[model samples]
Target: MARYWDDHTVYSQPSAEELRRKAKESASTAKKKGKNYSPIMPKSRRGEICTSWWGQAWCRNLESYADYSSRLDRGKGYVRSGTVIDLQIHDGKVLAKVQGRRRSPYNVEIRIGRLSEENCQKIIDKCSTRIESLEKLVSGEFPEELKEVFTSEGGLFPTVREISFGCSCPDWALMCKHVAAVMYGIGVRFDENPFYFFSLRGIDVDRFIGVALENRVEKMLQNAECKSDRIIDEDISSLFGVI
Candidate 1:
């Protein structure tokens, strides 16, 4: 007898419990093999993942791009479920290992264009004029005023055109679940260290602050000189009885 399977029948999807079990099994196996894994866990009991403003801003930047909105939900789920086994950031790119339905993990790479020297200098100049902005950065806060500097055209944050990504998963979508999880993981990383965001853009925070301090000092000296000149002119006019 020849048995034929119906091609039109829909396959049953794995339940949430089954997916979690599979993820845990794979993670345990990888750990036993001495594989280093860096998983993102929700900080709050209510499942709050990103607490810092910088982190939230990073996520918001991704969401603002309508093209990525569709996959963000699934990515968030993967990140929360400990599917992103490891994520590393380098000079101009991020590398990650994401666990999926397959026994083996998927590789993901996210590339962001580095800021040019001219653009870096421009950012330094902008931040230098605002002492509060530097203070906020030091305190791990993102200044509302500096938002324009980063989100503006040709700014620190990568634009849609400047950012590109790839995943080893079989999914053909431009951004697969693995890629999205890694992206969200970056936001969590930013929460832990806001400087990571600047690093991603290849900007040196210390250098930026140093240049801004110099600018501040120069402006102060010029203002003092002008004030002294005005005082001397007033004195001379008073002595000569001139208006």
Candidate 2:
């Protein structure tokens, strides 16, 4: 019988230097073949890849799941060492390529089910009630209140059960290092473009904002109309001596 991946002891893990060398070699070979490659590099002084609130929230959300937390540390190392060569987010899916010990890079795909219309409308209504929250989101800052909106049950971020992932690697573990690296890379990407998080969930931020603004305007108009009608009623009552 083939030994399981978990059967290998931690002591048998490859050194950081070895991983880095393999990544470089693989990148060079890909370049020779005229393939475009973009790797993720840690920017923080402490080698932390995710600094912004959006990025941290994404990483934290993933770690909250027991199924993924075990391999996240190794994935962090893979991302920091520039092992993820390419990552793309579109239509509720994330696709990536991660270099490992092997010469060929692994392909990773993560799918997050899109929120239902009712759930999205609920979020929009809640966010529209607070103009400050929308402003902070547009400014690339996630306020505490806004964070709560996303972290809430059935909110923006998908629960573990709603997420499906696959990695083209031989590892039998459900969450492999390559998949973890791609996930961390996505967090780093969110640091640069917070809106990508919504895009990954198939939410068009611009369109959502437009709808929210329109709703606000309509409410304002209704309030104004009601005030005008009340003023006219009072004027008519006074003119007819009805008090």
Clash list (residue pairs), candidate 1: none
lDDT of 2 by residue, 1-243 (tens): 776754764435666677778888887888999987777776862555788876888788888888677799889888887888878888899888888877778999999999889888988887777777778766766667777667888788889888889999888799998999898888888888877867888899988888877777777777776646445544777788985
Instruction: Report the C-alpha displacement of residue 140, candidate 2, in angstroms.
Output: 5.7
Q: After superposition, how far is residue 131 of candidate 2 from its true place, in Å?
A: 2.8
Determine the backbone clash count of candidate 2.
0
Top model by lDDT, which number? 2
Estimate the overall C-alpha local distance difference test score of candidate 1: 0.77
RMSD over all Cα atoms, model 2 = 5.2
Task: State the lDDT of candidate 1 residue by residue for 1-243, as single tens digits.
Answer: 545844455444444455567767777887999987776654642354688766777778877888888898888887777777678877788898877777677889999988888888787778777778877866767677887666777777788888899999777799887898898899888777767767788767777667777887788788776645445544777899998
Runs with alpha carbons beyond 4 Å of true place in candidate 1? 1-27, 44-49, 136-144, 228-243
Against the reference, the lDDT scores of all candidates come to 0.77, 0.81
